[model samples]
Target chain A: MIAVLGLVVGVVAGLLVRPEVPAAVEPYLPIAVVAALDAVFGGLRAMLDGIFDDKVFVVSFLSNVVVAALIVFLGDKLGVGAQLSTGVVVVLGIRIFSNAAAIRRHVFRA
Target chain B: MSDHDRTNGHRFRAELPAEVTAPPSAAEETPGERTPAALTGRQRLVKGLWPPRVTRAQLIVALLLFGLGFGLAVQVASNSDGDSALRGARQEDLVRILDELDDRTQRLEDEKQGLEKQRGELENSSDQAEEARKQTVEKERQLGVLAGTVAAQGPGITMTVQDTKGRVEADMLLDAVQELRAAGAEAIQVNGVRVVAGTFLTDSGDTVSVDGNKINAPYRFKVIGKPQDLEPALNIPGGVVQTLEKELATVTVERSSKIVVDALRAAERPDYARSSSR
Candidate 1:
């Protein structure tokens, strides 16, 4: 319940603040968002499965965002930023889908 | 005795009924009551998953999800805002804008290629000084034509304004000159006076003066340029022709294979200006 509340608060704050993202960080935001989503879905699945661990979820979320941003930053330095970003998004998108499927099975029992 | 007793104890427990030995409440409360080895893979997975384990973990996960949702919404909002202008534009307008951009790019590319060709010629010429001198002479001739110091001939339109009522003013004639220039007239002559870059028209009594040279009606203009462009420019609705005709003047535009602008201006040397190039 607190977790859901925290999520709601975060969304409300973001909407209300509407802070301008720094230009340097702007390119990595979308990839970071995708990585965050992957972590969220994974956490939700773990929660449903009763194996939800706070330490594990926090670490995964942090590491996912950091690693995803790092990969994009590295790709930029290597002059393959666009291609690498696409790859990151694709991989994260697949993970999100599978996690969603698992959630669906847990909730709907179908 | 000890071995026999222990064997009998095991046999006694095995022989006992399941209901008496294992209670349902105990099984429900402590999942550890059954050995882990007795549980299948699926059963173990289910056992690990059920019964809402930790509150703190849920809170943290929710917080992370909240952040993700916020970022997603902001991204969506920004994208929509950026796209709204182009999204609302008419297809024809969009296509025209795109075409204009393409035309500008093509023009720039052509200019770049021309410059590159000039540089290549300068580099490849065996007699570089001679080549440069030749180019300078060619450039001077082109400048002379523009300055109205040399006569020019081209395929263009001849506009004759026969003003019987004398309603045409100097300013009206000036307007006509401006319109022709906009339509890409390379060289223009009013009567026998050359219309140079600094040519000015003023009312001198009943006649209009072109650069202090009085030209009386019928004022004949020998314009050197593309006939198709020059003719339409004069004949456009409410253009020079219609404006002149409204004032009781007969404006006739004749397209010719060749129109000669023979009136020339003396090349005046500038006393104050000098070539800044090395």
Candidate 2:
């Protein structure tokens, strides 16, 4: 219950603050967001499986964002940024879908 | 009984004999015996998912998700804001804007090509001074045509404004000249008076004066430019033709293969300014 409330509060604060993203980091933001979403879904799945670990969740979330941004940065340096970002989004999107499916089954049994 | 014992055997692994011998009610009351594997798969899944385990890890994950959602929302909002004007524009307006942009690009491309050609000629010619001199003369002739100091003939339009009611004013005639100039008029003449860069018009009683040279109706405008562009420019909706007609004046615009503006202005010597180029 407290966790859900924390999420709501974070979202409200973000919306109200509306911070300007730095231009240097703007290109990586979408990739980072996708990576974060994947981590979130993975965490939800782990919680449902009764294997939720605070340390594991925090580390995975941070690593996911960092690695995703790093890949895009490297791709940009290599001049394959667009293709690499597409690949990253596609892979993350698949994971999010599968995790969502698992959550749905846990909640609805259908 | 045997099947029940076999399925429930894993549930009572530590206290198998005690659980077998104990009362069923007492066995059911113990929380430790409710192992997930002991229940059916569906029931186990439900049990694992339900009664909301709000762990610290889950709270952190939620916070991260909140950040992700906020970023997504802002990105979406900003992207929409950038194209909102284009999105709201009508199809025709959008097409017209695109056409205008294309026309501008084409004009720029033509200018670039022309400049490149000039540079190529200057570079490839033997005796570069003679080539430069020739180009200078050609440029001077073009400038002279524009300055109305030399006569010009071209495929252009002839506009005759007959103002029987004399409602046509100097400003209206000035508007026509401006419209023609905007339509790429290279040279213009009204009643044998040359219209140049410094030409001005003023109301002189019942007639109009072009550079103080009084000209009466029908004001015949011999304009040297592309006939196609100049004619339509004058005849466009709410344009020069419509404005002139509203004044009870008769306006006739005719496209011709050749139009001549022979009216000349004297090349005046500069009193204060001279060419600064070496």
Candidate 3:
């Protein structure tokens, strides 16, 4: 309940302020956002499975964003930036879809 | 019970050592209460990849999700703003813009038509000027022939003065030439020399010279004119024929339908004389 309240407050604050992202972080923002979405879906799935852990959720959320950005940075140095980004997006997208499907099943019992 | 569980079980065994392996449900329990040594490698991997139910982690996750939602809204707003340049305009402004565009198109069309009409008029005037130039050139050629500046051929008379003893002086021949000119001789050639307005006759030893070109008898004159008028002008009493006969020169005047005076003289260009410019 406290988490949900914090989420609502954070969203309202973000929309009202409309903070500008720095140029250096701009490239990583989109991938970070995708990783964040994957984390959110995974968390929702864990919650429905009666396995939700605040420590695990926070760790995964932070690691997911950092690792995804790191992989893209390394790919850029290796001159395979675009291809690696696509690979990450595809993997994350599949995880998101599966997690969402699991959450739907747990909620609707269909 | 399902193939999914069996596959997960195999993955767990392959990734985690037997001693570090624990029940998967350990992730749902209090994360702080469990010892790190009791947690399995597979459970640790799951904890790293998924969110836990702890208050602090959940709050952080929710905050991140809120940011994601805000970013999406911003992206949507910016995108729509880019395409909404004219969308914010009033109905009257849009109508006025359309009317202005129509007026511009109509003006351009009218300008094009006017230019086309001007081009047509210019073409017609140029064609008329070209025709006039051709006619002027033809008139100049005719005038050149009449002036004895060009060769001429037509029906006329050929007079031969047989002066065997060379009694015919240049003055008497000059008189005959003058008479032919008065009788409307279009072109005249005397002793192969073209007789123009500037021609002079002079006696040279035993022969007569026309324009400094000496000729031997019998002196032949090819005259381009009306044959009837030319023959009569020579045969009239006290004319060229009588004067030549009295000089003991046998003069024969023949009327032919075609006489060619193939002699040319350069037309003089007057430096000071010009046509009056109206």
Q: Which residue pairs clash within candidate 2?
A: none
lDDT of 3 by residue, B1-278 (tens): 11122322332332233333334335535666665445544444455445645555655666766766665554434335666555433345677888999999999999999999999999999999999999999898898887677778999999999998889999989999999999999889987899987789999999999999999899999998999999999999999999999999999999999999888888888799887895
**Against the true structure, whose lDDT is highest?**
1
Residues B146-234 of candidate 2: C-alpha lDDT, one tens digit per residue: 88888899899899999999999999999999999999999999999999988999998999998988999999999989988999999
Q: What share of the true interface contacts does each candidate keep?
A: 0.35, 0.26, 0.21
Per-residue C-alpha lDDT of model 1 across residues A1-110, encoded as one tens digit per residue = 55666677877777777776666777788899889878878766655444545777788888899999999889878867768888999999997887777655555444
* lDDT of candidates 1 onward, in order: 0.76, 0.75, 0.74
Worst 10 residues of 2 chain B by lDDT: B1-10
The CAPRI classification for model 1 reads as incorrect
For model 3, what is the C-alpha lDDT against the true structure?
0.74
Residue A98 CA displacement from its true place in model 3, Å = 25
The per-model DockQ list reads 0.15, 0.12, 0.11
**TM-score for each model:** 0.39, 0.40, 0.47
Candidate 3 local lDDT, A1-110, one digit each (tens): 44555556755765677666555665566678788778877766555343556667776778888999998878767867768878999999997887666555444433
